[model samples]
Target chain A: MSNLEQKPFNVREIREEFPALRQQVYGKNLIYFDNGATSQKPKLVLDAINLFYSKENANIHRGVHYLSQRATTDYEAARQRIQRYLGARKSEEIIFTKGTTDSINLVAFSFGSTLSAGDEILISAMEHHSNIVPWQMLCERQGCVLKVVPINQRGELIMDEFDQLLSKKTKLVSITHISNTLGTINPVKEIIQKAHAVGAKVLIDGAQSIQHMHINVKELDCDFYVFSSHKVFGPTGIGVLYGKEDILYRMPPYQGGGDMIARVTFERTTYNELPFKFEAGTPHIAGGICLGKAFEFLETIDMEAAERHERELAKYAEDMLDTFEGLQIIGEAKNKTSVVSFSVKGIHPFDIGTLLDKQGIAVRTGHHCTQPLMDFYGIPGTVRASFAFYNTKQEIDTFVEAVERSLSMLK
Target chain B: MNLIEKQEEIIQEFEVFDDWMEKYEYIIDLGKDLPKITETNKTEDRLIEGCQSRVWLDSNFRDGKMHFTADSDAIITKGIIGLLIRVLDGEEPKSIATADLFFISKIGLQEHLSPTRANGLLGMVKRLKLEAIKHISAS
Candidate 1:
């Protein structure tokens, strides 16, 4: 069905699905704006967690028992669900991981071995440490050159610089789809096409983008896409790494363990198939299942409306905050998501965060794991208010007032 | 005043503030009043590690007592360091090392000791006591 033909998103009803929103902190209703760090779990995801532990508790894949078979089915079904979610070609392309960090490390170690000295891996300046460090380690190991595509003052990537950086020596282009700190929605489709034209693969970090908007790997035609489940209203400790079938089949196994091996003898051990080869040991079975439930929850809502609601909330907060003297919004990207990071002229972000916490408002304050981005702005950190669809305009009003009050106390 | 008496004084002072805002205001005032650390002592070696905010602490042993001068990038963290120095600055190495710091909880600043804050207050306390221990062993 067309997005317009689908049921319109109801914020009030959506808010009801998350039990965490009904709580009070410091004698005031909690205003959660830390969705960038991790989103609050909905009832369906919670129920899936409980149901897996209560009824379907068993080891997967190897066991022939009833509960074991049920668990394996659920686990594999979760992979298929994620496959459909990302519009991946095959279930084998969706490899369950511990989180985004682990998934990136897997690719760095496995796909990275294919690279030799003098080969280049290109990444943007606005990448999270998770996306940056793994490639650094890969470069250090393989003696490869790591090239950085710098961003402009507005936190948008300089496509001209990226074009200059792309060359035959460029083995891979790993970049974030949406920056967690700046909320800048990067042009990954263009980046992927450009990278492929230069005989280079691209890995899109979807940790921030998966929650904010729809993503189809086939449409983007990225070599790899990675995201954590927790950031998308699912449980922690489980994530997905969606790689192209041909690329994954060619890459070596990440970890050695019982599940990842097809045949093991004292002399030699042969690895398992496409997805299993990457997945080592007993996985986060319950977390994977519940992550599937998180996608199911998203299916019930009109994502277009949710995306619009989040953007409006961010714009509303940004406009109100701009009116205050000495308040500088860090990122002013033309294409952005729901994250609004700012810093007061003279006041430290920590003090503002402390006072806002006392007022029962939750906002993330610091470099936000983007220390390089902070350095680019010539600041220590920023106070970031990230919105979700469940958040209301009323909450934004309360937040702005709290920030003003906090600034008054700080100044 | 003795260390315990000093802590009691702080508790009494905080009790006057009925809300977190007033308490925080008092802390900010304390931060403003903190004695500036010398430029030479603000070296990289003097900087305390594992805190959310950058804190530099330096110590001197004089007349069998430990003198601590500290500063922080964040004002609230600076205030917290001031509170620590206020109680332990002039005490003997043994006393400074052994004395329990009860003023933190009494002033409702226990949240600063949380893991999310990276247990920065506890790290500061540990560093201070370690300095005291070094002084005790040196002389």
Candidate 2:
């Protein structure tokens, strides 16, 4: 029963699970290094999608019909699956959302109402726009102060600065577990403990970390955790917001609609309980069910070994790319993940990205939804090649060569 | 040469380059020949912001003809701009606005027309047509 994968983590066999990997683009084998944006779904998740639409297509809850009951059962089962996956104590803590952005917006609108003027919400410099913009909107509405924790040149959060920023006035600390652009693995456990000492709730954006490693919310003991299913090889438009039971109960309902209401009356209406109170509209039933299947696919793999493989890929890529004369790796964090982002001295990232695309390497070249981080680095954007466990060292070799060729062309 | 003759000439030139690499090398050369707008004209107002690259377009209406001088931070995008300006410039506003731009596809560079393309050739084409429309409506 040890999923330590004693068989030594066969990536070739693992790559077979994803049909997308067995494809050609631009007359060459496709090299997908854009896992930071979204991951390709395994056949298990894909089949679940087909099964849901073909047979299990029905609106969940409130329906006494056979299909509706079946759908409701499947949908609730998915929530429980996610709850157990995150090591959440109760299923009531899991709230299905549109994605990570929607989950953050939900907390911003519902829990944000609890804060008054001059209350501070602390966030880090490397947070995606999804994490930053919602809190900014919350601040704008409530006159709350937005305090930013700065990062070092290496893209690691300055713990000293974070310590100085955390205070009684700080109501919340929302930070990313991993930077999407820089691949910096933030120390969220330390952050959570520090934030809690000052009576501040911490929301860890797990959009980057969930698929890469084993996440136990009970162990982390954070107030809230949010991630997109799409980034975790699940269906798009469905995500999970894991909040502490007590905190979720204290926050008001996000949207008033069918599923979220316990009772509806023009004169007086009562809201639903726990997780249902936050889930307002008719949910993406297929997406919810298929995401559970995505979790099932993940369970079959040894995530620890996979994480090791990804880290090795990052190291190999970084070491190879560092040799170029004018090329500078954007983030040099000691503890990082699978992303290797770099900028050439004079060449624009866009031009390099274009040539790479023609060579059948799918890379992301832009600010990567971290404009403030880009501003801090004093660069317009970077060419980011993010790796997954299925990616081989051979592919990195090809990718490095492509980068070299592209840089030569651009220069 | 008229717009049609010039497009045929460019298409013929691209036809010789059998491979994408050769085509790109030629385009990179073409980028060097792009009629660049001066730094003063490269203001925020002239910027056509793309998802990846930045483009600046300078439009002038002279003698009933539409003249465009544009620049892009990315050389590939600049070369594409060069191609657009080659056929459209010196043509009347009405002709330029309605000109069927078939050469981009004929030259096997239609991928740039995709909205997802970082160079934002689709946006450039739209801005170019928009420039033409401005002069057409004025008259």
Candidate 3:
């Protein structure tokens, strides 16, 4: 069925599923617009967390007992569920990680070990520090070159510049699918194709994209995709790293520990198979199982409606905020998601954020870990209000009124 | 007034405001009344690291008293620094070094200036006392 023809979903009903949305903060109704930082947990996700610890608590993978076998089954089932979620060919390609940061670091260390001095890694200007630092450390250790593809004033990646940066020397092109700060939906599919033409691998950071839109690894043809569970309305400290099986087979194991090994010997220790080889130690069992529950919750929602609702909330906020004098919206890309970042003239973003917090409106302030992007804009930071499917137009109105009050007080 | 007496006085003043809004307005007013530090004094040596806001503190020791001048990029943080300066400035280095400045919690500003605030009020206080220690030893 076409996206426009999808069945309508009740946003108010969806809002009720998230318990955090029904609360008062500082004598005002809490308007949480910081979904870009981390989404609020639904009741199902919360229950799953409790159930795992209460009823199904045990170490996974190697236990032959009932609880161990049950835990192992649940954990592996989570991997399979995530595999289907991302449309990967096999469940073995999904490697459980601590988070997106841990996942990227795994690739940087494992895949980076194969590189020599002259190999280059190309990243975008708007990458989070997680994506940037690991590659920089790799460059420092292996003497590889780290090049950044710059963005335009609208926060969109410069495709021509990306094409220029691509070459045989470009061993990998690591970029974010959506900018957390800018909310710019990057042309990652096109980027993947272009990078592939030069025989370069592409790693898409889906930390912001996984929850907002549909993701298909096979359709995108990306070599690697990484995202955090917390950002996708799941438990923290668990993430997924999807790598092509052939490429993963070539890379070395990330950490040396119990589960990632086949046999331990005095001289030589044989590593385990594909996914477990990278996952070291006893993993976050509860986090893994609850992540499956998160996906199950996601499966119940009309995702197309959720996406449209989020976009509508953002546009409503943006339009209202634009009417306020001296307010300039940052990252005005043609294609964007549910994030509105703005700055008022002659007022600091911190001041606005503080005032907004006092009014029970939770928006993010400062550079948001994208200091380089802030430098490009020639500002210290912007106040950002990011939306989720559960957010409403009434909340946007409340937020805009709060912003107006804050601007008046500050100005 | 003595340091403890001054802190108690500030706490009593804050007690008049029942709502956080009024209290924050009072703090913002205090921020507005703060004396701006001279541009030359905003050197790297005078800057406090690990603050979310940029805070520059300058001190001079005269007649065994430590005179402090400070400024912050954020207003609320400036007000906090103002409160710190009010209780400690012009005191003897020994007194400044040992003063507890207990009014922060009494006035319900513990969250804003606590060690975990990340706005670096705790670090600023530590640096101020360290300066006092240096002055006391020098004297």
* lDDT digits (tens) for residues A28-126 of candidate 3: 999999999999999988998998899999999888899999999988888888898799999999999998999999999999999999999999999
What are the iRMS values of all candidates? 1.5, 1.0, 1.7
Clashes counted in candidate 1 amount to 0
* All-Cα superposition RMSD per candidate: 2.2, 2.0, 2.6
All DockQ scores: 0.61, 0.69, 0.52
* Runs in model 1 lying further than 4 Å from the true structure: A1-6, B38-41
- The number of residue pairs in model 2 that clash at the backbone is 0
RMSD from true fold, candidate 2? 2.0
Once model 3 is optimally superposed onto the true structure by TM-score, how far is the C-alpha of residue A34 displaced, in angstroms?
A: 1.0
Q: Worst lDDT window (10 residues) for model 1 chain B?
A: B113-122
Please, what are the lDDT tens digits per residue for candidate 2 over residues A1-411? 112223457899889989998898878899999999999999988988998889988898889999999999988888888888899999999999999999999889989999999999999999999999999999999999999999999999999999999999999999999999999999999999989998999999999999899999999999999999999999999999999999999999988888999888889989999889998889889999988888877877888999999999999999999999899999889899999999998888988888898888999999999999999999989999998889999999999999888777777
* Candidate 2, position A249, lDDT: 95
Question: lDDT of each structure?
Answer: 0.90, 0.90, 0.89
**After superposition, candidate 2 runs with Cα above 4 Å error:** A1-8, B118-120
Error of 3 at A59 (Å): 0.4
